[model samples]
Target: MTREPTVAEQSHPNYVKVWGVLVALLAVSVVGPMFEIKLVTLVTAFGVAILKAYLVARNFMHLHIERRYVTYLLVGMVALMLLLFAGVAPDVMKHEGHQWKNEAAQKVVRDAAPAAKVH
Candidate 1:
């Protein structure tokens, strides 16, 4: 014996459509670099990635049917990630003086000099 799909199942968005949208978003991400605009390409790739993530989460992970608390948790996680990135951004962007090269050159000169002969 076989069972028919329920009304809820019938009302859900078609899996094929969702998969096609994901593929289209992936294509956008792949082709975004061809434009030769760094900011635009980055934004396009990230946007497509976010969209694809949403689609997968909603359809495959069934987040669309999840409770409000789950949504809140996801939002909180995203906020925390942004906060962490902001906290680290300044240190990551800082360009400290290039002391390594000077140290390397000095070490080379020091090593090149002949060692004194021990009696």
Candidate 2:
């Protein structure tokens, strides 16, 4: 005899539609940079990435129908990670700190600046 699916697995979503959307967004993200516009590139890259992540999380992971606390826990963890990154990023990104200097790192940054500006 076949067993019935549990509640968590019962409400099926149209995964094909979601997959299609994701593929379209991926194509946009890839083609976005070809225009060589900084704003367009940044928007398409980051915005599409965020949308794709949400779609995967909501549709594939079924987070929307899961217990509320599961989503809360995930958000809380992500917030903590961002906070930690914020706290450390300044020191990590700086080539020089109190009583110390990184000549090589500074040189690399200086050399890369012009190339970065061209894009």
Candidate 3:
């Protein structure tokens, strides 16, 4: 015998609605870059991405119905990602002429080498 869906499951929004919302968010992200304003386009794209992520996690992954600990874990994961990016940002932003120094050293070495005697 087939079992009926629980009341909680029935109370959730229909899958089609969730899918439609995801599709709309995706469209927004895709169209956002067409704007000439760089900041506005970036914000719009990231905003849509966050919204789509939330919808997928809550509805498709059933995180909304899960316990509080699961939500906390998700939040922690996001925090960890932010921390990692923060740690890497400074290194990415700073450059101390290392490339130029390497090129200068190479040129000096090439100049010191004796010319080969060709037959």
Candidate 4:
């Protein structure tokens, strides 16, 4: 018969090591933003952010140490984050000539003759 792991066997060296590694990852992320980087800087910055968060959630938060519903919770959080990130670019970059209408309105205001009636 197969044996189920006792709590002690399942949580030991790896658990402590995980917390240490998670701390290191967090330090790296905190330091990543302090550098005087150039145009491609954001790529690396956010990359570190993602890595650190993953480590914390999966390790320190012990999401991987799931007992019952934690797995679903972590998966759901990750999925929701993915969805939000996926939709962000389109939401930020999309403009279908709506800005042009704003420009036209400004021009109309600028070109309008002084109103002959002031109440």
C-alpha TM-score for every candidate:
0.66, 0.78, 0.67, 0.46
Clash numbers, per candidate = 0, 0, 0, 0
Task: Give the Cα error of residue 114 in candidate 1, in Å.
Answer: 32
Sorted by lDDT, highest first, which candidate order results?
A: 2, 3, 1, 4
What TM-score, to 2 decimals, does candidate 1 have?
0.66
User: For residues 1-119, could you state the per-residue lDDT of candidate 1 as single tens digits?
Assistant: 78965434634768898898888888889888789799878877987788888888888767767666888999899999999999987555543345524456556566767653331
Considering TM-score, which of the candidate structures 1 and 3 is the better prediction for this target?
A: 3
Pairs with steric clashes in candidate 4: none
Which clashing pairs does model 2 show? Answer: none
Which candidate leads the pack in TM-score? 2
RMSD of each: 11.3, 3.6, 10.5, 10.1
Per-residue error for 73 in candidate 3, Å, reads 1.2
Which regions of candidate 1 deviate over 4 angstroms? 1-11, 96-119
Mind sharing the TM-score for model 3? 0.67
Instruction: Write candidate 4's Cα lDDT for 8-110 as tens digits.
Output: 4554447667668767766766676677575335655677667777776665555566575867776789899989989886644443354534555555665
lDDT of 4 at 15: 66
For model 2, the superposed segments whose C-alpha errors exceed 4 Å read 1-10, 96-104, 111-119
Instruction: State in Å the error of residue 62, model 3.
Output: 2.0
TM-score of 4: 0.46
